[model samples]
Target: MRREAMRHRLTEEFFARHSTVVAPDLIGKLLVVGECSGRITEVEAYSGADDAASHAYRGRSSRNDVMFGPAGHIYVYFTYGMHFCANVVTDTVGVANAVLLRAIEPIDGIEQMVNRRGRSDNLTNGPGKLCQALGLDRSDNGASLLSGEIGIYDDSWPDRSAGRAIVVSPRIGITRAVDFPWRWQLAAERNERNERRRPGGSRTP
Candidate 1:
């Protein structure tokens, strides 16, 4: 990808919808953070109030305050008294919705990721792992994605994922709201089912 051609980033409007919609559209998109970047492959959506699994389900707090602020912002949090997880804040201001970035196929800065994660294989196969590999933590919680080290990008205008099939499944790792079926991913590259979801709205070369 050309440096000038990749200048366009996913704007606030791209993430202004419910996380469920944004989640699937994110597949095949590039997630860039400073020198590290990757192609987003999997994500899961969570919303406020109705979603029992969401941190904002019990209303806002210091930890989840960013989720209700705006669109296209990072909503990072620590978990399991150990690893951190990164989420993309979605929907409009005052609406608590986010998409958990579950997995990515490394596209840039692999050596840095390997060093951070202590291994190359499966470096970003899970949410916690992805965050660790990307060096994201609670400190990045409220940063805007528009013009910073963190941004979701894509190829030239109108061009998209070649209509790759998006696999829909129930979200994992949470006991509550486990059957919402909001998890979305590209159908494993080589899978040959006709099922497809076309993504619209992206940066231009």
Candidate 2:
């Protein structure tokens, strides 16, 4: 019998949905940047025209044109004049909605990520930190997730059996839309108690 490797990749249709739908679902997905891989632990959603916090809220520009491209592409940009942050393009061809990959749990290439970040703590715990640890820069902007050096795979899916629960909170590291509870993360242990109290389990938003 021919051996077949288990594989699962999120399709463009998956990303073509609203950012809110894509954000929480991204948790537990695998982000593969070159040889480094991690399980997505956190993400924040940004609506293009509706969200004041979105880069394309006022319309696209030279720097944010990639955000308006087709879904399933990467949108990397420089920030703080010293660090790079990355986001995943979402919605339709003209829509600029996206989900910012806030943090991840390292699963592969730990040594390389540590070397890049020069420390282990918070290596991929923030937008900029995750980009740096994964060696993602502006050059990776507009890269297609379907065929590129960087890709997201659904190799592992978080569920009750995985002992994890999704938590939603307002986005961090931003002033605009700070009150919007659009951030999502995996609660490793707290969900057990929540699951017992909440009927029909938790739901993503």
Candidate 3:
């Protein structure tokens, strides 16, 4: 099948809603950072002020002020004192909600991503991993997704298997709010297909 060459960027209006509403919906979307692009495969939602796991739960600080900004902006931050993670701010200003990008299915600039991460099997299967692979860090914080170095695009291709592809689980790597099923990811079969579609696989270019 021939693929179409087009990118429909998601509008800010799409993100001016609850983080939970946007988290699972981001699956299958395309995330672009400079020359690299990938299909979003996993994400976690964090609602500020109430969600104990959220950074904004205790109110705004210099480090988390971006989370309370307008929607459709990147909110990059450092964690574990050594790793970086990226999130997409959601909801209207002052809401302080965001969607953490956990994993992505590399679709463009695969060689670059592999070089950055030194591995392909789990290049972007985790938040910190994906951030490193995409060269995102504190410098990318508060960047507008509508017209910035980091952006999410609509794949345009019809995904008839989306319902079967998505699965939910409690957010990982977090000790608080463990009961909320706020994490979403592509199913194992979908991940296998993604791997098979890579450069040296049967679906090679």
Clashing pairs in 2: none
Candidate 2, 9: how far from true, in Å?
A: 1.8
Q: What TM-score do all the candidates reach, one by one?
A: 0.87, 0.86, 0.88
Clashes of 1: 0
Total clashing residue pairs per candidate?
Answer: 0, 0, 0
Per-residue C-alpha lDDT of model 3 across residues 54-170, encoded as one tens digit per residue: 999999999999999999999999988989999999999999999999888777788888999988767787888888888888989999999866788887665433565677888
lDDT of 2 by residue, 24-131 (tens): 888888888888988888899999899999989999899999989999999998988998988999999898999998888887898999999999666787788889
Off by over 4 Å in 3: 1-5, 158-163, 190-205
* CA RMSD, predictions in order: 7.2, 6.3, 5.2
lDDT of 2 at 198: 34
Model 1 spans > 4 angstroms off: 1-3, 156-163, 191-205
lDDT of 1 by residue, 22-70 (tens): 9998998888888998878889999996999999999999899999999
